[model samples]
Target: MQQDSTSKDSRIALGLALTVRHDGHGGVADDLADLAGLGAWLRAHPGTVPDTERYRADEPDLAAVRAVRAAARALFARAVRPGEPSPADAARLLPVPEALRCLNQAAARTPTVPVLDWADAGPVLRREPADDRADLAAALAHAVIGFLAGPDRPRLRACHAPRCVRYFLKEHPRQEWCKPSCGNRARVARHHERQKRTA
Candidate 1:
């Protein structure tokens, strides 16, 4: 396993941005398409999106989160500048300034209170939502901010294999595509292209 000291929330930001994935059938799939889907996604990420086990999701919350996702995706496109962005959102990306405003607004939606404590390791400080009930959009936006501004920012990459629309952290020096399967697909596609040219 690749050892990384990145904070869980920062990693969670990448997860949040990846909620929109390429469906195997040449289309994009959104995990937050409905309240049920949103609820399930939240439940899957326990502590990061707290209170989701019994939490009731509504249309407004879903809409808000989708908006946050748009902003995150746009900023992700900016992060990979000079490189092609994920084809999934390439044509639909919001302007960088608008994306920035949207993300900032969502992040500020929830007020956080800092807490200080002593642990076995040492004194630690953390922040908690003021109301104790976290805003889904705010939490995700915060994570997006953390990941994009953290050390791993430079490692973010968009996979370009046929019909694949995903972003991943480049794990090693030789890494190219997001996964080995993507590499295989790319190589196969390249072979086909070479054959076509020769034929």
Candidate 2:
């Protein structure tokens, strides 16, 4: 489905936020299980990093990356479902003050040596480095902030399919499940319910 820039960004943020999923059938699954996994995820989702090559070359601190991921997930969870208790000790990972601090830091864009480019049929502006960890945190923070503050925020929803714990941006007014498979599952579940009611 074609989505606007904001929606695309929001989706990316959501993907990051939901790296750890609760498997309703049993245990949980974590995409960022380790440093290698984290690195792979970053490589796959280049949008999450300021400069994929630079980030990969730097070999960012694994501990710091994990911390940022934890903070981002906590912050997004709270934003996605306000008033709900966040993950255990999530506050320590990313407290309100810390998140706001990162947001403010990212908001202030410092001037960098201008570079002329003709990549997009016009000149493109590139800025200097602003602490990698902080930049990533800020990117995630801004993503959630934009999503929450945008019109589409109201349409954000969690999948209702049994044993599924994924969030999705509602495409249609009546859309509920995240995918057609989820919708089919719900339909089968309803059919079972009807049979039980009659029996």
Candidate 3:
């Protein structure tokens, strides 16, 4: 109940965005990281870095991504509301339905993870597909979406760090931070607190 409607929507949208990027590419791999970067950039909002070599910062597509993020955030806000709304209440929000539809579609197609071709001639020797970079990029996004909407929905969560804009799935219910580093940072701060108390 305490979760603000906007926050919930943002969390869900963020979850969807993150879901679309989990292509098993790796931390620094081009294909994988580009999708991940897009997810991060979406949450960050303005001043997004759209690498042309990777995702092509063309006007229409980039605008589409930005709009999607905005719609998603708005959708989350609407989703966490406490009750049913009147007809007039529905009239007040136009984009919510479309946004919800997008999320639903993303969720519906959300797969566990994409199967890699792994037959490419890259230095890494992974099989690569003949699809162009943009298609591959789209595939990454689609895959992320599918996984999030799948059976593992509950694991999705926003970053616990107040100002950080990131989303991650909790491996455990008690997990509070987005990344291990964030958790460790909190732990180290706590260690100093305990030390001061003992002293």
Each prediction's total of clashing residue pairs, residues at least 3 apart in sequence or on different chains, is 0, 0, 14
lDDT of 3 at 123: 37
What would the TM-scores of all predictions be? 0.89, 0.61, 0.39
Q: All models: lDDT?
A: 0.82, 0.59, 0.43
Q: Write the per-residue lDDT of candidate 1 for residues 1-199, one digit (tens) a residue.
A: 1437656755677777778887878788988888888877887777666766776768888898899888888888889877889676688888999999999999999988999999999999998888977688888888889888888888888888877777778878888788888889889999999999999
Kindly report which residue stretches of model 1 are placed more than 4 angstroms away from their true locations once superposed: 1-4, 118-124
In the range 3-44, model 3's lDDT, one tens digit per residue, is: 342333334345434432222332212211344555554454
Candidate 3 Cα misplacement greater than 4 A, ranges: 1-57, 72-98, 101-141, 184-199
Q: In model 2, state the lDDT of residue 121.
A: 78
- When superposed on Cα atoms, how far off is each prediction in RMSD? 2.2, 5.8, 13.9
lDDT of 2 by residue, 111-139 (tens): 23455676867878765444444355445
Candidate 2 yields a Cα-based lDDT of 0.59
